[model samples]
Target: MNKFRCLALISATALTLMACNPASDAKPAATIAAPLSATAATPAVTNNSSGKIVVYQAFTRLFGNSNTTNQRFGTAAENGVGKFNDINDAALVALKGMGVSHLWLTGVPHHGLVADYSAFGISADDPDVIKGRAGSPYAVKDYYSVNPDLAVDPAKRLDEFKALITRAHQHGIKVIIDIVPNHVARHYESLGKPTDVRDFGADDNTTLEYSKHNNFYYVPGQAFELPDIPAEFTPLGAEAHPLKDGKFAEMPAKWTGNGARAAKPDFNDWYETVKINYGVKPDGSYDFERLPADYANKNHAAHAAFWQGKELPDSWLKFRDITKFWLEMGVDGFRFDMAEMVPVEFWSFLNSSIKLQSPDALLLAEVYQPQLYRDYVQLGKMDYLYDKVGFYDSLKLLMQGKGTSSEVLAKHAEVADIDQHMLKFLENHDEQRIASPEFAGAAEKGKPAMVVSTLVGKAPTLLYFGQEVGEAGALDAGFGKPSRTSIFDYVGVPAHQGWLNGGKYDGGGLTAEQASLRAFYQQLLKFSSEASALKGEFVSLHPLNLTSPGYSEQQLSFARFDDKQQLLVVSNFAEKPVSFNLQLPADLIKTWQLSAAPVVFTDLFSQHQQSTNPAKQHRLTIELPALGSVVLQRQ
Candidate 1:
């Protein structure tokens, strides 16, 4: 079901249930027992060069917008869109205190917005083709400019965005921007494009179905037609739109973004965009030469060397120039949208060229196919890929009380070979909120999951802007729906907006429960970022403690060891207390090379101590509260 309509049904069901049992709407005392404001002060934050890497994903336009009008399908004038000037020194300092190492500023690049910029010599995007009044961030209209909606002065948008990058670096956090190379808006025009660079379709021959040099595929003797709108859908929801008619102007219609070759695409298809040609023929054959098998093991420099003398396609060079332009502008890296749709060879060329310019530039891709994971990382030179098909989906099932904790271990084991290259995240722009009714239905349920996801591996961790504050995505955005945050419209996030606290960047007006939840997230993120043992070898303790007393299927246990210290982590996902004898495997002790000695173990999180004589057998009795996480360190 569409997320927006699905939320309407959810809302009706909730209202009915509330009416049926009025008393059930009251908050449970157990979960609502936090102080009205956070009592304990956070520790001082410093730049730790060797800490666990963390990425904070913030929607560029929503981060500093304090407007609460929240008009559905609201215009910029009504809702007051956040500008690049809003993210000031206070914002970066707050993010640094949360242990953020990287800042992913989504929707920073210039895209199709409904606002009229005709004064700046920019054409207005048609409402029939745009997703919302603000438009989808993926529909790139100009590759070399920043979104004017995010700047204090529309003429100085690019300069304002660069200043934000500089501000992020001052707080010891790197920056990442989106690079949507798979497609472009149907009316792609680069008004601010470089003088030497040509537009996407400048030289394309529209007469042929497929050509080695053509930038797009065209259907001869056909005119572009709008998709059939559903009976219930409206362009602006009872508001007048000047360009809402079902007509667009494109002679010899090109293929849709999703490879739909028909002149008229389905409403469900990505009809607002057109696919970019990457030398792949209509029969799914590659015209460009594939990289050698040995290139998989070679560094990016070697890969760059192999492509130096080759005659690359026009699309390939254009994208390379686009990425290079951003890299030069101080964007630390990129998150490629729908990366798998484009050929891996093009990525090999693009990424290698990227590394040739800046070796430390991060490259993350959204690739769902498991079979192509290694190919994309190894041959495509991608630094990380989303773990949605396995780890994320499995965790969601467990959170909804439909699966066991052992399945999480199994999911990790399945991706053991590529675990270091698979980034883990509890929430992002694409997923439902943990506190939403469609997911776990409570923010507290995400505690154990977040603990494991952050400390489970060497890969980087990600936290969406409002996740720590338990922002339930329940508002009805114009085109996007509830459950997941609206990437298509202009709206303010309630929980995160509270954290903004009217530009103070503190939780000034949050309820007791929210304060406590934010505190929990703060402690967990800080601990994960500073722990030394988390960067070393890991072994699953769950396999050895399954049969122990008081152990259940809702418990997960693991150990990480390095040369100087060893850490034992145990998390309880159930609603009841658990007391169990967690046994350290004989093999684990032998691997640690410990002689017959009494090891003193200290709980880093709870400040409890225990001494276990492992001369004969290695075991310790552990007590964990409901939804608890224990991190014990042995020195």
Candidate 2:
């Protein structure tokens, strides 16, 4: 045999060993399997009323930039920045075609950056406090303005953003933007605030360490000091800018975004932002009225009623107004950053206010603490919370060949009660790409994981911009390092640009492999968005198949069904081909009410077919290729 064939045979053997021996050091391959047999088949469900929610998150500044000059610490001028105009109708249509119901335009708000925009009445940011040349999106410099860098004309930035919103709406897609309620940039200034509104901390008592009326927490008589810089690093990489001075001006230094109270925060602290005071005293006691125990079961309208005629902190009211401002400006929802750090009571008040304005506004939060999931969802009135720590983390282990499918099922069962409210995602701005060296090392490895993530839950799925095209995020762009696409720099995403194809919004430049990957994502996302069974019940088949012949720990099996549609979903994580007789449990067989006659199953992706007798065998034989997945619909 040739060398390539020999290598393939060796790889197949190693994968078989890894799957058979759970403790083996061999790398696991990727594939998936699930089986169901039914003679009396129900017709495929066509109800599309309650479709699955698929969110497409795109970093607005980086989404449209086609520049390939990935210069480390490069200036925006050197490496071009994507603007609001870049996301035209063609881009929105492309996103919509991929089953995107909501498009989250990250980094739309005006934030503090090191660039000089003084000509447009905007103050230049000090590089000492900025995380990157493009600035951190969480560090809001203004609450009522758009990022000038995102607009062709800096003065008409808001108008351009409004145009983008209109275009997205025309394509039946809602717009979501980031809302960092926990903190703001060190130099918070609202040049576009209404005439009646005052900037944050404008009316604060600077000497007091804690006050309900104060917008920020103070360190009392201390001046702000920059964190100790490493010897190899300098502000703006020692670039020739006047504002690159290694000093920031802030008297009576406020607490850092991470709640570091020191005048000089640690280098790793969120030093770019200052924490907002939300009526929580320095002793960690609440200064505002706490909600009643029964209020947790109440709806958003009732929660809004509970807050009526009650006193609230100034910061809470300010954030409420900020969300209301966005809602009135045609924004459909918000992605709250570091939501757990803020008080749950504040979320109750703020989210209720948002619901009152736009009843269907999507309220997605970034909360990692599993213990606080129900509190943030029920009392805080959030629509969805990130399923990162539990579901995403466990699946990541499985993809890395460190765990079994059993762990994934256990984690899913743990959150089964609130599974509908937990949003599922494999990639986001905060995560490493599946194609990166630090992650799965290949985009194909994510296929089985993606199948499981989509079929295992009744929650929304998030797809980061370049995730479909397999962007490795290996560029060393300025302040942002490899493995994650930089949210803090002006850089191009090569794979996405290949699909962008210089404003045509076509995958003209994509290689065959990349194009194939994109096609898989497109088909899967469309199926996820339209399938009615995905919105219904789910039952795991992993436990029953654990001891069955040919079934390995690397494979997962499950069933999703309702009155209209029945789906047998399976995924293989092994690198080698796997053939197994997948059994159906008695309960599931009774649920489907199958007869003794032969039942046929059809593959949704490949259009393959198989059959088995429900009463005689109670199982179907399934064969899956390397890194393969199958969604078999009973017919």
RMSD, one per candidate, in order: 10.2, 10.4
Writing each residue's lDDT as its tens digit, candidate 2 over 177-197 gives 999997899989999998988
Clashing pairs in 1: none
Model 1 stretches astray by more than 4 angstroms: 1-48, 231-235, 594-596, 613-616
**C-alpha-based local distance difference test score of model 1:** 0.77
What does the lDDT read for residue 168 in candidate 2?
94
Best by lDDT: 2
Give Cα distance to truth, residue 134, candidate 1, Å. Answer: 1.1
What's the lDDT of the predicted structure labeled candidate 2? 0.81
Give each model's whole-structure lDDT: 0.77, 0.81
Give the range of the ten consecutive residues with the poorest summed lDDT in model 1.
Answer: 25-34
TM-score of 1: 0.91
